[model samples]
Target: MKLPYALAKRFVAGESLDQAVPKVADLNEHGIKVTLDLLGENVKDRKTADDTLQHYIELLEGIHAQNIDSSISIKLTMLGLDIDRDYCRNNLFELLDAAVKFNQFIRIDMEGTDYTQATIDLYKEAFKKYGKHVGIVIQAYLHRTKNDIADLAELGADVRLCKGAYNEPERLALQNMDAIREAYKEYLKVLLDKTVYPRIATHDNKLISWVKEYTQEKGIGKSRFEFQMLYGMRLNTCKALAAEGYNVRVYVPYGTMWFPYFTRRLKERKENIWFVLSTMFQK
Candidate 1:
């Protein structure tokens, strides 16, 4: 026997905003913030893109109504980046407008290599117009990340640095584990030194320890930066960090398009699949 996807529902809030809202509210009660993500990508048409933007608008409104302490993370492709750049930009602006109305923030999530430049371009446009209300993600595994960080720093953008999930060629990305970790640490230093508020997104315990020590050594206050972890992957670690009075945000993704996202998680950490399977077989 193997664990059904339904069993993993404990990890995913649900497939809709209605289902996710309560879960996020509960996390807030425990003193943990959330970055809510409506999980879908690479929309094929303008209609779908508009619909996605509307869904986010409703999500923002729901969060506002509930008085939840959370922000929304969005993927450009879900806003029609692949269909048309201007169209995508327009869709993003709609969501940004909603965020502005609610006095909330929108985090632009980084995708694969093909969309990298466009994503950065969109972030630049948004940051210029909205400033701190917008933030972007940086993938440490990418070879160009150093330059990317430097450019983003010049804009004083808020950035979340993550060990990338996408698989890429050696020329474009760091394939070695140690190399990626080293790059992550270096990038962390650059972001912390230059950006307004940088986010370190990782689940590796050793790296988390290193970051705690480095930030303290650099005299960076716990409020200046945050540690981000995916929902359910490391609940205890997240709680411990929160208990220590450090900012910790859990990335909570919800939508019907969870298969691709779930598969990506499995591919990144194959052991997770075994854990799922074992859970399914348990009496």
Candidate 2:
């Protein structure tokens, strides 16, 4: 059965870029930076991938045109990473070219375990030219991510650290929440120590508190790193953090292809279901 758009609206910005504008503006008005995500993934053909590439070009154009203080995030699968690597790279290059013209930052979003290495390889290639205009995400649950973090640190890459949302086998990812948290702490320390700028992305209250205290003790200034969260999740907390003068950005995805994202999010936790019901008509 198909889910109603209304139910999904609680999480998604809207079904099109035009609809997403006000939401982006509203978040910016509240002093929260926004990162726009076009929201389709795993294209099996060239046409879809090509179309997805154009969408981002236009997104970058719109951001520059409107003078919106927002960045963008793109998933490899959405750009045909599965269909063809060369094709995917070319598509990414086109988007990066546009980002250069518009002076916008593009974040390469990490997907499943299968896409990890390829994603990192592509990001490294892009970083050579785009530099800080391009950023990469690292999931702490993965066994390889610590090593990945070390390598990225060498480049002084800007990195975003998250607990990861994908479900992977025990062979690849940490199955226990405690293990993942411990790994996240270790990853955070490396990121703060080495990366040019680290983005701490999490909704866990304990982790948030720890980061705040740890940074103070270690003498890491607020401008050296920023906190990131998904749009609509922990809004109050995001505001509170921003009010405290820390940079906070929200990942706001808008598109007609929201089913996959919507289902995965609601199924992630029982609390998310009530959370959705509570935000039925919220802006």
Q: Best lDDT goes to which candidate?
A: 2
Report lDDT per candidate: 0.89, 0.91
Model 1 segments more than 4 A misplaced: 1-10
What C-alpha root-mean-square deviation, in Å, does candidate 1 show against the real structure? Answer: 2.0
**Worst lDDT window (10 residues) for model 1?**
1-10
Model 2 scores worst on lDDT over the 10 consecutive residues at 274-283
- How big is the positional error of residue 108 in model 1, measured in Å on the Cα after superposition? 0.7
Per-residue lDDT tens digits of candidate 1, residues 116-204? 99999999999888877899999999999999999998779899999899989999999999999999999999888988789999999
Model 1, residue 75: C-alpha shift (Å): 0.4
The TM-scores, one per candidate, come to: 0.96, 0.97
Top TM-score model: 2
